[model samples]
Target: MDVRKRKTILFLGMALFAMFFGAGNLLLPAYLGYQTKIDWTSTFTGFSLTAILAPVLAIFAVAVSGNYFTDLGARANLKFAYLLAFVNVLCIGPLIALPRSGASVFEVAIQPILPDAQPVWVCVLFFGAVMTASFSLNWITGILGKIFGPILLMFLAILIIPGLFIGATVDLPPTIIEDRFYVGFHEGYQTMDVLAGLIFAVLLISGANRKGYTHINDKIEVVVKAAIFSAVCMLLVYGGLFYLGAHVSADPTEITRSSLLVHIATQYSGVNGIYLISILMILACLTTAIALTAGAANFFERLTNGKLGYIEGVITVTLISTLLAIVGVDGIIEYAAALLNFIYPVTLVLILSVLLFGKTIQNQKPYFITLIVTMLISFIRVLVNWFPNEEVFSAILNVLPLARFNLEWVLPAILTFVITCFALGRNLNLKRNQPF
Candidate 1:
């Protein structure tokens, strides 16, 4: 690639990295490190599968299909496509992820320095800036990549490098969870990067096109290269945080995710490191907030057929998310977990089906059957969580493979797809050979 192209790719990669590396991204790995102890290697491998690999693949899935909604919605039909897009927007936008970002800034960054700070005002000021930056959607890649991305990386390095070295001197405790890999895999869901990938892919593809990558092959190549670069950056930072969390000499169970991060920072560099982490959290959260707001606004503007303008979408999302953020980070987190359980499995099925079957399975019969089955199975899983004591439901669901692993939908989805495809294929053959 030429120098200009190379520069565009690098900046796009950085912007993607910043968008993915939000509060949940930072907190989950650190807490996993604390829990995994000596089994950090296997645990992190499992964590990386869901947190990094699945998300990157989701981006590729969208790229291959050419349009995010059209490709994703191909199998299920137009109405399903719109509904899925709408839910994806809400889950990753104002309803859950966006509010969590602001709440995280307050709980992890602001609360440490100003213990008495009002969350409502914090969200107001924070999202006020987010709203302003989000209005310039064309500039998101440049703003995040050229400016905030670098600063976020620098602060993370400052916090991580010293913590890793300092932590090495302290002997750590035994692993808390016996099944480290499984625990890490399950915990990785909380990051929600895979779901975000479906929406964020649109932004990345648009950014690449604006940078003059017009050819389909060129866009695919650029997205792949940029995703690789972003993945490498994420691995390094997540690895460093995990190392810090694993090596902390203090009682890991006693501390919350944000508190543990702050504790480690303060331990390594006293008060200065605390301030550094605070800045890091704010920037990380702010950049992601901007990206989510922009993505949602763009999608809504299109969804409403221009009735809802981009600026209006931003304003509406900002106001809603700001109010939700005031509900506090923990509450947002609790609610998000429930919603993710419902949506994520269906999304996974959609992405994987597209990648595996391509356009061949776009016929409504097979597509809808597979997704409906997956959703039904996943709903049962969620119901089990809601009513743990309901023996009838729990016992019925337990027979499915990986039910204990929170992956009860996998087998059912695959089986449904295969059976539907076979039935559809035989019908087509019979019709073709029959005498008119």
Candidate 2:
């Protein structure tokens, strides 16, 4: 708590906020509010649980584990740990998030101004910028924390402060969804920051180390404090936007999510609103894209045991992300939704298990059993969505607890862990070999 330490924590917190507040963070809450209307409170609660609370917990879990994501994941076993790491990184990096950043900026910020602009060229230019800006972990955080983070916050403040005066002008519409909390919970999956948190933890730890917090306890303290700071900032911004959305007089069905945000911004501040939001989208998306590119490069070099150089990884990831960006935001979101549904429950289980049982649960069997059951149930749920008419799958899934909430995996994962622990008894107390 010296002056320098406080300054480091402040900047780290700002950088973490910038990294998490990406395309989904900007777009989802307002749309959820618009859809839920009078039910905005309950829906926002559910959204904040996954979107805000879960990601912060993911950061804490890694910090407590005294290592990066691999150590946390290796609680199950080395193979499963590595598999989840790669999938989580790819999902948040090139496949979905990285590309969606550019695509969203194009759709929301660019296309409206330049009707003739092609997304391909915009993406190429965007990724080219990302590639050039890719720096070491500490440098990346320093730049985002000191520069982009403040500018992004300033842009948000310009729009959101005016938004508070805006209220529902029409007869507020009735809620369309019966289970508003569940709908919010389901929508929260689309944010995907919880998944990003696992990897962002790596960057945070490295940043702390270079800042000279070399003691293990000191490292955990700085990371946890910074994460809490980020969580507060996210809740404020997301809550403001969600409240603003509830007040906007627009049809959710008539407008796309990104467009809905644009509409609200314009309503709040008029022509100047458009300018603020356009700039917001570019800075927000660019901050996230840059962070993801750096994070991905770090992961690849680690995965290949340094065979893949950091610069090479950055170039390769940018190239792939550039190609995928051409598909546009909605298309990427459609694909990401399905994939996230399948993976999120499993990831949540892993994070919660580590935080809850990681200290005493020495044997990997319990973690293994719990995660496998979670994955099986989650996969079945995804299949049920894909083939809605399959009576057998529907019948089996509906029987699970929380099915109405689209969280049917929760009960089974808990039951499986308990049953496995009881069945194994003292045998479950066996020491686990270190994965590393």
Tens-digit lDDT track of model 1 for 248-349: 766645798779888888888787877887888898899899999998999999889889999999999999999999877778878787778888888888
Clashing pairs in 1: none
lDDT per residue as tens, model 2, 153-200: 988888788778666454567778788888888898998999999988
Clashes of each: 0, 0
Best model number under lDDT: 2
Mind sharing the TM-score for model 2? 0.97
Q: Lowest-scoring 10 consecutive residues by lDDT in candidate 2?
A: 165-174
The positional error of residue 110 in candidate 1, measured at the CA in angstroms, is: 0.8
The collision pairs in model 2 are none
Q: Per-residue error at 96 for model 1, in Å?
A: 1.0
